[model samples]
Target: MSFAEEAWVPTTETECRIEGWSKETHQHGLQVRSSAEMNAQVVGILPAYVINFDSHNFGIEFQIIGSDRGWLKIRGAKDDPNRSKLPIRATYPGIGWIPGEQVAFMVQSGSGHQRPDAESAKLLDLKGDWLTSMGKIVRVVACSGEWVLLDYSLGRSRNPQTLALKRLTEAERRASQGRAWFRGVCAIQETSCETSWP
Candidate 1:
């Protein structure tokens, strides 16, 4: 299936940050739109929302709440819990649009959530504007509060280089039933993330 199709896989993450790798190379911000279309409508802008020239990558770690014509529909922080705010009023204020350019893709916290975040999912992996921690890659089986469940079949044969997969004893294996919870992220990373599991 296409990215847009798999992006909203129920368990898929739905959050992302628009920024460049570094400020020295990138010195621009993202233009929030009313829709995904280029000519849709200029609602607001995310200051410093960047684009790295050295590394042509955009979409990184985030919970993708939306996917349409390459646009990711994410949640916007409202001024108050009352929810009376919109773009132009704030940076990416309310569920606005951020063009999915270059390498527009979303991922979880490496082993953050092996699966996708539900409607209440916010996997941007953004800690107040700083990109950090690239965890391992694992297929998500389940997710709890602040924890993600991973799936790795240690059956007759298993791949040693399966990213963040870990070896478990017969008891542990049976307990996990070929599934285990490891620390990782699903958000796509330009480099890689570490998965602490076994």
Candidate 2:
């Protein structure tokens, strides 16, 4: 995406530090974009919001972008009973997945969001930010309270070693399925944050 202005919270901010976040250099490097490139494709007329949960501190950062789809707010941890206070939205980004293919979920935490403040967090400037996969997209569902789940199937024969759009054999699929699992991280807003990569 065209990062007009990069917003980062530094390696400080007890709740949003970026030191301990998972970092993976994408084998298929992403194509960076410019503002003009961003204008080329409409992320749609609407904007996408982010819901950040700090499991350690039990705080959440609910941020929204403006009409320009720019981030509007960040680091909202106040105790507000009004759910509307946290405006959250989801974007498909046209990331596809197949019916029977294995897929992975990657998340950026800690200093991941950078500016934890309201101003920096509201930048809805996602242009070319995407993850390319070998699967086809089936459907995406949104839940109440700002939760969006992407449902997709992974073919048992897709080879992870072959990054250039390839599949594996039945034996390879079985070996992969045997070790499949899910894990998460915890961020102590304004205190400490850590990530677990498997």
Candidate 3:
């Protein structure tokens, strides 16, 4: 489907790493499905892993190209971060698919979790310049099938855990650096962050 974007130039290639399926996957790891649908095919079994979520069972972050339905696609094989938290060790660059829904990218606007240079992205806005909203967090600007393009700040500020542990205000941890291509079906959008961490 064609979508008109009002934010920055949409990007497919990203320097930042994307995450998928978050669970206590210490058993036999997650299965890399051959196809997009469930029960498609267990092409491979990836060892359970964890990302930057502290204690959660997430795999290492890497260049996840895109997603289909609820799965994140790995462009090339990626391995879990070298460590014990990885449950089972899969060499480097393990190949597979991730359940997109399992990821919770809840970005809040006005919390430094929106566009890094939103004004610049607005300046780069191709169409709907007037409609360019740096408002309401990162609004869905465009979509290629299940992938929606938007800007977000990935930093300590975005993590609720850090907020409570560090006793920091969201404003202090803001780090919206650039845009990201995400499965629109799975984004957890938030405009007001009234729920502050205790």
Winning model by lDDT: 3
Report the lDDT tens digits of candidate 3 across residue range 26-74. Answer: 5676666765568776776655545345543344334455555445665
Weakest ten-residue segment in model 1 by summed lDDT: 16-25
Q: What 10-residue stretch in candidate 2 is worst by lDDT? A: 64-73
lDDT digits (tens) for residues 1-198 of candidate 2:
235443331231112121111111232212212221333433221121113353222122222111112211122222222321444423222211111111122322111121333233333211222111222223211111121122223332333455333464556534332111111222222332254322
TM-score of each: 0.33, 0.18, 0.39
Report lDDT (CA) for all predictions. Answer: 0.36, 0.23, 0.39
Indicate the TM-score of model 3.
0.39
Q: Which stretches of candidate 1 lie over 4 Å from their true place?
A: 1-28, 49-63, 77-90, 102-198
**Model 3 ranges off by over 4 Å:** 1-26, 50-58, 77-82, 85-88, 91-95, 104-198
Clashes of each: 31, 28, 11
Model 3 clash tally, residue pairs: 11
